[model samples]
Target: MSKKILLSWLFMAILCLPVFAQIQEPVKFKTEWKSVSADEVEIVFTGKMEKGWHVYSTDLPEGGPISATFNTDKLEGAEVVGKLKPAGKEIDKMDPIFGMQVRFFEGTATFVQKIKLKGGKYEVSGYLQYGACNDENCLPPTNVEFSFKGEAAGKQTAEEVVATTEDLALADTASVDLVPLRIGEDTAAGEAADYWKPVIKELSSFGENVNNESHSWIYIFFAGFVGGLLALFTPCVWPIIPMTVSFFLKRTKDKRKGIRDAWTYGASIVVIYVTLGLAITLIFGASALNDLSTSAVFNILFFLMLVVFAASFFGAFEITLPSKWSNAVDSKAEQTTGLLSIFLMAFTLSLVSFSCTGPIIGFLLVEVSTSESIVAPAIGMLGFAIALALPFTLFALFPSWLKSMPKSGGWMNVIKVTLGFLELAFALKFLSVADLAYGWRLLDRETFLALWIVIFALLGMYLLGKIKFPHDDDDTKVSVPRFFMALASLAFAVYMVPGLWGAPLKAVSAFAPPMQTQDFNLYKNEVHAKFNDFDAGMEYARQQGKPVMIDFTGYGCVNCRKMELAVWTDPTVSKLLNEDYVLITLYVDEKTKLPEPVKVMENGTERTLRTVGDKWSYLQRSKFGANAQPFYVLLDNEGMPLNKSYSYDEDIQKYVEFLQTGLKNYKR
Candidate 1:
């Protein structure tokens, strides 16, 4: 009897061991539902594995690892269609323990299944059976349950239906019919339209291009600092530094008080500039400023403003504030005491130096406003103020250092004239943006390049004393610094001359108009895509029994053009793209409008889709979870992704391998 009782306890312990092991499994499962159409839904299952553990794929061979399997409970009006599809990177290796090749997924994996629905809403209950293993141990097969419910179709008003239909018709003309698959009236029309809305906030989070707000702030700060340094060399600002510091030192017999007052004056300058930056940000708001940065009207305005600034620098006219303002501030400085006197003095200097510093400040603000950060302008102003104030504070601290500083003279006027030429060249960049957006054809690639070449050539001649401006001294001999500036200007001009006939000119690609705008061609590569539309490219791929390569780009995208010239121009990459795949180039900046306007909801916000660019931009965001340009994805004829997507990488071999890998996967 004792032996039998011991055996019974052992048996019970053996049975409970499996249950305890199942509870310790490291993989977790989750399910989500997406409406594909009225009759179909996409069920996405994600498996998250703990560190150092992995789960086997469904296609693993027999006697290898335990493959993941999905089984559904009885459904009221739904049936599974096709097989489960894997949607993440997979690893294949020869396992010594199993003595066979095996495929598994580590970290996270997404598997999708299509389900056909009859009607109404339904809860799809399912259980996923899978096994996980680490380097040291393997767990037995375990089951986890999940359920998700979604509506088969959203209710759409008659106007919405009509608008969607007309939009589809317009899209069809562009060979990009975006109609949701449904019989008769699309029951998923509202759902489809909602999916296409601009996901601006989400794109920065989950999309491939993460927000670099901090990085942008750093760049803006440095740019402002450089601009401030340039402003200090101007005739108006440079001469005042010595005079202002001498006034403070000579007026105060106490050296400590003189230094303290000078530092206060510098601090006051910083405060004033930073306050202006804050005012601009508060008035416009960050989001509005971001939009304004991309607006055609604002670009044109910036262009005109820069041109005016250039003219001022060229001695066309003085850009000055009212004299009364500076005089009042000057009087206040004389009447006040302590820090207040220094603050008033700093304000007076700012007003007096406006003719020189105003253009620099305006250009800096215009550049900083383009950054997508709320505090970017403030940070930029702080940098500029710090640079502008450093010299005055240091000279006051060590009065003898002022003797080492270069005396203001005719060279200051030369600096201003050189800056004038640079301003004129940069102003055209803003004009190019407006011209491209509005399709004005006023400044094409060749025309823009010609203007730049002429401007820089003339600048070179002026620097070498061959050309003279109104404010230039009568000296004909070029200084050492002027000679170097002339050489740089001439070299830059010579470099840009090739760009007129289709040279990439990558150094200035960001500023120059796109190469497509050039009529004549000499450096053209032979990798042109046969189709620039999605549906047409896919259809061609299907007919030819090849995979599809989708290039999500933009007309204004500098990186896209760079990749085309730098990487895609390679013979290996070009052949693979042109022969092995049906290439589709979707320009997300195409501004042509649709036949009818369609409104869509995104994260509770309503957005109206009106242009061709909007439709392609929406497609890229919705389908691939990305919004940045120069995005590349490989797809089979069925629109299923073949492999991992790519972004702005300029490696030729990597791109060739990406294409080859997609082709291999498609053939398999």
Candidate 2:
């Protein structure tokens, strides 16, 4: 009877083992902030695990158990400079549950995130998400919230703490007189006003769509189509159109059958190009290509590639595939029948005409890749294919139309050489991006304009038959078409001359180095922001009893510059901003550190303001719920919205009205 009773108790204990494990928390976390430099701080998270229990590290592969992750729920005054780093005695071994190698800490784990403060004071708040496991059981992912605040690095705290009389008496004997700083005062009344407070709820009714939608894909497609049209005029492609059509007409006695074959051939061309685009996307992946598009190495490589293509177009040498490859493709086309044979023939054309079309296609693909859309490459190719293939099918359907087409001659070479010069000019733009990123300053705005001017002038001369390339015919007289093109080129060169002296030259602002880079400029008839600090600007506006216009912009914003040049330069708009409103321009990308971090509760979440930019960005987001740059808001002295906000619209009249409405509202 005693043995049976003991066995029953053992069974119950075995069943209750997992229940006991569930009731006990295995890991405890403690977070601390360590000032690493005058402008940097490190948030250290230390995790203590119970014996035989472990927690996973970050960056484990997918399809495995959850890995540790640190999520910043609120970041205001400081920027996270680097990734979270883990340190401890980690056990990296394969786990049967995940069937993969996993890393975890057994006794203790330390994670650190280094942050750069825009100002001396900063507040950071986030949660650590981790999963703990043991030999027989696994714990679900858990979150531990952390909040930290610190002053400027190396700033000793002067905070006074009250203590009991006995504790105070235990201090070292030093004769000192302590004086009270303030007594029986209303501290709340003396506290500084918060400029970033949420506006009245009625202001929400005036909100506009803050989303900056992109329509670049449509532009990219049309650009590709234009490129295809240009490629069709090249020497290699123009001559082949008639010959290919003639062969198709002669091969089949029935004209309808011949036309059908031509259509099939054109479709094959599109398939070939579209497949090439899909291959590029699949090989590189969208995320990687997006990153690569902005990388310095990618920009430099594209610059060199364009230069090489330009040289080839200048008649330095032909860029062609090996003869054997085309020969082999031609042989297969002859052997095959029906659509297969037509596809092979189209493949042959692609290979043979690559010398002429290769540069255009390469350049098209390069530009399209920068759009960062996964399907952009393929869409661009589709447009190019339709434009290229249209001529072949149309000519075959109407054989008589072939005679009206312009004969391939010196004009074709002129087209090619013109493209060469344009390519050379555009290559500089790519180099400029890399130069700015690395602070090389080798190719400044003036230098770039000079090169473009010289190149375009030379191109104009070439069009006038005064300049000759290697492939040009010895013709002294220029065609009427060439004369007009030359005039346009010279006119464009003349237009850019003013830009050298720091003219906004709104036309080329997107490509040119910013006006700030120019060393010499005479154009000063522009509007300037009255203040950059929110608090200072708001207080001054209140004293002046004027409306406030907050311009949320960025250092690298292209549209912001365009708006300033196009709309802000208008006399009416400038007058209102200068006289009727106090303008505050906040650069969201500013890197200046703040003197001290300011803490505030925003939307029921704590936010730390460590930099000037952070304070402005937080204001824009919390109050306006907008983060995109070139954001404009009109407010009264009390921080209430005066009118609807504006964005990248450059309509001078509309902008004038926007300002007038706000000024009128402020007066009311």
Candidate 3:
């Protein structure tokens, strides 16, 4: 009975884990008002936050979290005596999420507002707004409303207490309910417009027919598999393959037993790497992974780390774990028996081959962690491990294949050196992100293109034996395979030469700096969005009777630039967007401040949109339930989606079909 009870408890715990992860509210509040004197009253708002979560102080600067504020709608027969002030233990420090200095409060917070009451009955009601965040995620700004009704410096008779409906001035609108404002509606009485409507439910039906989740996972897996295949050619991993297999074969007299052990060894590799991926996700969380990948400080660190790895691959030095660690793992494998021994052996290989595989794994994580999927890192590692482990099991099953395998030679070092060049070139991309974010202008388009051109050209020269590295063999000659690789590299370098003069290199647009950064430009043909404001664009589309194409993009989004350069540049797409549809490009990362902040009620929480980017971002989330960039949706004049939305696809024909579908729906 006890065992059954334990099993039931474990099952319920597993089910509850997901429910806990979905909880977004971390702070709770209560409010009270007290009479301080015959003519004075104090309103106190107290908040208790969850552990490790904090609310930003009332004095944070613009561009950070929304500072705490007291909003008032009605304060009849009373005037605020002083500013709303906070009484709590406040913390001031630099915040990594906003990349600036901020002040916040944790645990408990108290805010007091003093009001002087006129000599009559009075009423006061309003809401308090603030933003909260933890290390991993930031919640939308939230509001807590308060109301007080009392009489001050007056003794009312029984007849006076029995007042008419007009004398009992109640709130016109409920605190929780919002007055919906239609698009292009006039407000003669000065009612605020409801900009963020709950359009997500209506938009769901339009996109229900389209699904890209499985395709995205497959793509990431294939990329990691290719990286694993490349690592197999490195000198460190290739030579060890034979030696590790031989050890497994000699350990057991029975060939079947040896093959089974090899299978276990391969499985162990997968488990180790996948666990590492899971550890990363569990430690930093999905939201933090996105933040870390795009952070300027993280990019700079990644840039420096990649440069060091590239130098190691160039034979400047070796990057490896301590000898004692590998020795200890190897010793454990020899001492242990059965499955444990196999896992230890696999671990030993992982430690020993770190110098070759570490860079590949690091680069793969950096690329995939930008995605919103929490399991992306683990899925990528799973694919990589499977590819890396395939040969061991295959060779064990067919020993004759080992004799046919190519002998390790100077060619292995050649592949490593080529990878070094690629790493060196890719390292600049991270630095470019940081440069663009900080407006440093250090690696502009022309300068970035010049460096890439030189790197690929030098790589081509190295492949043709025109240059020598520290580990290169003196007798290295241009073989057929090497010759073709050199040809391709030289061609790629020539292709990018046009980019230095402002030509968009569509093939490398995903990696190269944007064309706007280039000083010189010869390319004149490019598609431009008609409007950046959502309401203005929708109004124009309504007047023209054209469908609306809203392009949700960002400055730092790599795939958005890829689609723009690759598909939007096509004549057909350009013409369709320019003529048949009203194009609206909303940049979610744009930092320009709005003329005046707008109050929006989204997901039952009030959010303050203080910047242009914040307004667009709120529109995307409240309207479509998506926050990723390069999101394209076609809507009618009423702002209802006409067709399935599109995201990050570079196929020009499919994009054309998407636009046509929306146009067809609109005409009907």
The number of the candidate with the highest TM-score is 2
**Candidate 3 wrongly placed segments (more than 4 Å):** 1-220, 250-253, 278-298, 331-337, 365-378, 432-441, 444-446, 494-570, 583-642, 645-653, 665-668
The lDDT, on a scale of 0 to 1, for candidate 1 is 0.71
Candidate 2 colliding pairs:
77-608, 77-610, 118-593, 118-594, 119-593, 119-594, 119-610, 120-594, 121-596, 121-597
By lDDT rank, best first, the candidates go 3, 2, 1
List the lowest-lDDT window of 10 residues for candidate 3: 164-173
Q: Per-residue alpha-carbon lDDT of model 3 for 396-466, expressed as tens digits? A: 98888999999998999999999899889999988887787677888888999999999999999999999
For each candidate, the alpha-carbon lDDT, in order, equals 0.71, 0.73, 0.76
Candidate 3 or 2, higher lDDT: 3
Q: Tell me the alpha-carbon RMSD of every candidate.
A: 19.9, 17.4, 8.5
Candidate 2 segments whose C-alpha is farther than 4 A from its true place: 1-207, 210-215, 436-440, 514-516, 533-547, 554-576, 579-581, 587-599, 606-615, 636-643, 648-668
Task: Summarize candidate 1's per-residue lDDT along 1-668 as a digit string, tens digits.
Answer: 69999999999999755210011235666666666655776767677777667778786766456677766755666788988777798765444224345677888977778888766665566555565666433443444445555445565224312211000111111122233221122223333333233232332332232111233677888987888888889998898999989988998799888888889889999999999888889999865675566567787898999999999999999999999999998998889887888899999888988888888888888877766578888988888888899888999999998999999788999999888898899899888777866668788889999999999999999999988878888978788988999999999999999888887776786677766677898985657777876665666677799898888876534456678887787888888887888888887656566665555433333344555666665566445554455677777776777766666666567777778877888889
Candidate 1, residue 312: CA error in Å?
Answer: 1.2
Whichever of 1 and 2 has more TM-score, that candidate is 2
Two-way lDDT contest, 1 vs 2, winner: 2
Instruction: Report the backbone clash tally of model 2.
Output: 10
User: Scored by Cα lDDT, where does model 2 land?
Assistant: 0.73
